[model samples]
Target chain A: MATSADHAAPAILNEVNPPELPRAVLVENNRSFTWITDKICGIIEGKTPAWWWVCFIVACFVASFTVAGITYLVATGVGVWGHANPVNWAWDIVNFVFWIGIGHAGTLISAILCLLRQKWRTSINRAAEAMTIFAVVCAGIFPVFHVGRVWFAWYLFPIPNSNYVWQNFRSPLEWDVFAVSTYGTVSVLFWYVGLIPDLATLRDRFMAAGNKLRATIYGFFAMGWRGSNRHWSNYEMAYLILAGISTPLVLSVHTIVSFDFAVSLIPGWHTTIFPPYFVAGAIFSGFGMVLTLMLPLRAIYKLEDLITQYHIDCMCKITLATGTMVGYAYAMEFFIAWYGANPYEGFAFINRAFGPYAWAYWTMITCNVITPQFFWFKKVRQNTALVWILSIFVNVGMWFERFVIIVTSLARDFLPSSWGYYSPSIVEIFTFFGTFGVFSVLFLLFIRFLPIMPMAELKAVTPQADVHGGENHH
Target chain B: MAAQPHGLIATFETAPEVYHAAEKVRDAGYKFWDCITPFPIHGLDKAMGVKRSNVPKFSLTGGIIGFCTGMSMIWFMNAFDYPLVVGGKPYFSPMFAFPVSYELTILFCAFATIGGMFFLNRLPMHYHPVLKHDTIHRGMDDQFFIVIETRDPKFDAARTRALLEKAGGKDIKELEA
Candidate 1:
């Protein structure tokens, strides 16, 4: 019988084994190492494109509203927004969480995927890391202005005071100050270190072009990198160490952010699962933002071969996976609320779905949970336009998720008499929109001046550039 | 004025070619020699007989300092200086101390890594003897180079040139300091 089954197994195996598909190249167009560097570096070396200026102008115009909003808020007070008695933490906190969550994908690509040896990250990591820095900057702006008096913001730090008052280290808010600042600092350092060799490339290219001014400027930032083996050895080690240290931060920064809500005694906010949920949600929304940025830029820059369909597909799958995790967390939250039989928690979940903020809650569900599920189809994953559109939906959905979480929880408390409706005032709306402007302006400037892709890294991944794999050797 | 001739620089078309040349040069017991490439070549360090970098060790030391600093700062500030109790949590809670400690560890480790890299490589030394060679610019592009310094103990011009030529090196140039 065993022999008979063995004889039958070949037939079954033949049926199960799919036809061999041609392996996809991460860098498309069979681009040579020299071509990779020349093409990517050319973007910075050439005159700034007119569209870049147009986009930059628009971004600057939008970003100016941040100044306007902050001025209005300062001149008046926090009262300009809809932070009433119960809903003290409304749009400001919501936008803060949203932007911070958006920042996570950058580090996730640069650090985590790097550790995993995912070479696909090389194409997108530079831009994504820049996005991370800008997003964190946008994220930082909210909490500072939310303090009502920005000058006293130093009180958040544990600097010794003459009056003998110290910040409470036990508070998650204080932990946020440390976590976010450290994150920002480490990200900038990591980005600059990665940029050095590429900057040197730019310097050499400009020097060859007889542009001494550009060469001098780039050379200053390049730190005189000569690509010496001695330098390469130390540089590689430092980069690896930075990648190792950054990995924990990718998880912890958002976990600590979740702790700000989880440590609270509020019915919906207090949960053990908040950390993982927030992290998954962060990566989910982050990939959404990355897709939104990369899709258009890839088309405009004609970087199709570098930022290939393979990369976009993989990113879509990640968004789908993280979105599914977010959906599961939403379900778990509801299930736990019901299972625990706590009136406040149960009422909070129900109110989020059926009460006054039902529209926001359902919008979050539709955009984040439902939209990404479309990516399960191969065709949908491959379609850039559709993916871009869906990514926008995910962004909108994530914002609503935060809105629903903060507002719905606070809108109706334990006592029915204390229940109140919450809505953002025009100032609050403009302030939130202004952050996008700031983020865009910074990102636009980065793309204009800097090597948006890591030329060295992109070269490293090309076929002929492989040190160990010499099959492509000329 | 013409700069002093520092050494002979030999260019290789491929990584393996350079790796083999580095091995030959290293086996010949040449010190004060260096390989330059557009990117870090795997096994090239072994070929060049390069020692393991102490950057990680510096990072570890920095991380340890950071952990201690984080713990002590929290303890001294919250517990020792002004013991204000909110939410009835412990004054010196290790649980509360961990996030700041973790962030500081990463922060210190990152700083130390970059600092150690620069220190170990003797970087920010804008001028180098090799930079005077025009062909050396390709080292930042798609070329490989091995320069056996004139300061090397085994630096005979004829022997070094012969060794590099035998190792498939092309475009051998005598660079000035």
Candidate 2:
């Protein structure tokens, strides 16, 4: 059945002899460092308009001004913001909890899914990890800044002093300090470790002759990786171990954060369901953030083939699940408020839904409870335009959810004399804006420096990759 | 330096061809050859008569050690070193210990899975005789090929070439150690 044409050795290589170079192929036309960098420079200089960069800058501007407002509030007094006798905690606390909640999906995707060996993760994990780090950075900034005397924030930690007083480890706030700091450190490390291999690949692909200095710098960060089997062996092992470590941390960190509220005997704050409820909310908001970024990202990077419709579909499913969980938590809170027969608890839920801040309540329910249900339709989930719009709505909804919870319950308490409506002052507003700016700047830089997708991981999952088969495939 | 198996390296265009050839070779009573490919071809393991790997057993052992260590540490710390009533709850409450215990189990199990997988596969290794054979690199790309080691007792250069041709191999070539 075979002709000599089939029998003859191919021109590329004789059947008996092959080239020594690894099977690296050029992914795009004009595969040179100079060419790639020039293209990137062109994008920056408006030889090509990086629309995402423009939107990112606009977001940064808005976020920066809000942060400025926060700085002003800190300088003046907590009184400048919406704080009265009983409702001392307001927008600052709400935003603090909201941003922290928004950081969860990143950890879930990068750490949990990595352990699960979900191949689809290759497309988004890098960006998601970057998002995690930035979101956490944003989250960490709030708690520290919200306190009036930001300088003495270090007092939160337990350090030995002449007074011979030790920190009360029993306090949930103390637990929060430890949990958030540990979570941030581990998240950063997890992200950076995963970036090493991909960064090295970029260095090899893009390092220039004259730019050897920059190349060496990026290369050093890349850790002298040569993709040896010995390296991959240890690298993969370490990654798995880190993932294992992060999973419980993901669940615990938010739980401890929730304890900051749940431990208090305030009518609204005290609840057994706070821990799991907060986690579900955090994940729900976090997915909303991911969706906000994913749509434009795939287009900007020309990664439609890599990111695909499948990823968007999967993320929509998660958003819906977590959104429902959060909705359930809301219902459970209302039920417990009634069942406990605690007058203060009953008033807290009643006022939240029907009080002066009822608009925030309605907004939260509409955005979080009603909006995500649209994703149940396969067409809605797969439609990039619709997904993008809904994701934005989810973000606003999640933020409002926190706003409603913090303000409504605290503003109108059992003692009507102490009850007062609260609103964010100018300072509080600026600080929130500035944090968003910082997050955007960091993310834009990451996409430019690193391969937006994990190419090595992608290569591994490809059907033609050796490791996909049994280990002994010759 | 080693006694050579005089045999041809055969490349198949698809996975099924490799499977069929491996099956035929097993039926012909050749135990001195092995097939390698770019990807794991399903059912090729049975066709090649390769035994199941012991990676799972290693991971299980590792997981057990991790779980025990994790639980013991938490018990010793909360029950032994510092016993303070937490929220008026009893010491050694399983709920309080879950985080640390779960962490340990995961730590151990993951370590075992990765370590065992590598060890069982004899990996993290730098040397391979096939690396010297030029065409072997393609095994990671588009083609599937099998080699008869030089040390195999049935190796004969001319007869092996004829056998591979009869087995429907196209463009067979001699492989060197």
Give the worst 10-residue stretch by lDDT in candidate 1 chain A. A465-474
The lDDT for every candidate, in the order shown, is 0.89, 0.70
Name the lDDT of candidate 1: 0.89
Q: Which pairs clash in model 1?
A: none
Q: What does the interface RMSD come to for each candidate?
A: 1.4, 8.0
Over B34-150, each residue of candidate 1 has an lDDT whose tens digit, in order, gives: 998888877788899999888998899889989989999999888887888988889998888999999998888889889989998888877888877787678888899999888
Chain A alone, TM-score for each of the models? 0.95, 0.86
CA error at residue A4 for candidate 1, angstroms: 29
Chain B TM-score, structure 2: 0.82
lDDT of 2 by residue, A332-387 (tens): 99999999999999999998888888889999999999889999999898789999
Instruction: Tell me how each candidate scores on DockQ against the true complex.
Output: 0.72, 0.05
How far residue A417's Cα lies from its native spot in candidate 1, in Å, is 1.9
- Name the runs in model 2 displaced over 4 angstroms: A1-63, A70-80, A207-210, A466-474, B1-177
- The CAPRI category of model 1 is medium
